[model samples]
Target: MAAKRPVDRPRPTLLIILAAALTLLTLQFRGLQPLDAFQQGVRDIVEPVRSLSDRLTDPVQTAWNGVFGFEALRLENERLEVELARMRGNALTSEADTELLNRLLSEVDIAYSDFDAVVVRILGQPPGNFSSHMIEVDKGTDDGIEEGMAVVTGAGLVGRLEQVDRSRSLVQLATHPDFRVGVRLVTSQDEGLAKGTGTEGILRIESGVRLDAQVDNDEVLVTSGGRSLFPGDIPVGKVLDPDSDADYRRSIIIGLAADLENLSFLKVVLPAEKPEGMR
Candidate 1:
């Protein structure tokens, strides 16, 4: 037996409701006050929920997108951190250079001391435990610096020029054990051979002046020009309180005038020109 298919049924209720809705929309457009008021009320009630949904969904959508871009954000932050560090380092270096320039030749009276000088900067110390009493400089024969030239700072004498190159020179500091300078007492006029004790920043009169010489505490010592390596009247150091020996001699320690440990700028003394005939 062949089975017949069930007939599809259409109800008039849905059709009637749709026709009513259409009639209401047409009347609303044609100055239907009640329907307009009803639509207004419906919009007012739904608007808050719609706005709340938009607010909530926006952040969630943004967070979902951000999860995929987290590595890019982290990399960007690291790059910013490096840039900030480099800027900070440059600021500190600028401040340090400003302070170093304050210690320039203008701070001292080199012209009053009879030195024909050229300004230079200290490069570094020689690399050895034994060579701690030397400093390398940025000028040499090319800059008219010669061996045995006096090296000085604004405060006072630093050392003498040692090894000379075309563009660089080594300064043998006054603190070296073999260093020697003829110095005279500013008050008593006593002259002596001043030698480094290998002690840090200290020198002593090894000989030349008698043990009974009138040396006083805090007395100023200056260079003696006759046959001396350095010119006369350059301030060398101040005598500390002399240590009295029972019989041998007074142990005198001189505090160096220049701060050798933190040198920055320096001057090399050129030889004085002979007076018209000795040249």
Candidate 2:
């Protein structure tokens, strides 16, 4: 009578709770409206708290996603930047090619365009003003580019072949300090010599321009036929206003017709008997 009975465990309470959970799951699965209504009511009661909790956790989830995606995004940006630079380089190359094509087409209109020639690429050029100023061309005796032959572009005469090899030639640019060529004025028909003045890309006619000769700025000069290293009527340069003395005898300054610095492709004309013509 003194020993108490073992305390009864709440087995029925656990069984009741399990039964309720199973009943709720079965009713939800069976598409009963009452369970759904209860669910809705519960959701309505707790929705604000759920929303607040989600708001608090949303920034953390987004930060995790950004950290994981940043490397991929950076790689994609680098790829795009490389592609853009490549496109820009291609555009620049295309533009340069177009310019060369235009120059080749315009060469046909040069005064000595009828001369038999070879189209040669430049291999090298003088590095500075102090250098020999002789450019190397890809054509030589093999291509019939001989000594004293003219090297010209669409713009006009730029050089003459002096050092010839079997496969290549060295061209003495007209701007060279030792360069000299007989010249005749196009407008006045005054015969003169275009002599390099030892200055960079400058030529002067210190002797030929007569005091009485009517010469003005931008006067065209062509190679004089007789003893000139180049052919006659090959436009060499244009006169930029001359320097006059007391007797009005002038040292005519000539601006080179060809842009020597930009030579790419050029025509090496075989020397021929000088043609006679004047405007």
Every model's TM-score: 0.56, 0.55
- For model 1, what is the alpha-carbon lDDT of residue 75? 90
> For residues 198-246, what per-residue lDDT tens digits would candidate 2 score against the true structure?
5656788877768678887766677776767677777787788666443
Model 1: residues with Cα > 4 Å off, grouped in runs: 1-112, 127-130, 244-246, 274-279
**Model 2 CA deviation exceeding 4 Å by range:** 1-110, 126-130, 245-249, 273-279
Pairs in clash, predicted candidate 2 = none
Per-residue CA lDDT of model 1 for 51-158, tens digit only, reads 586568878867976998689778978987997899787998867744543332224322325678889887666446757788877776667777787788766777
Model 2 sits at a Cα RMSD from the real structure of 36.5
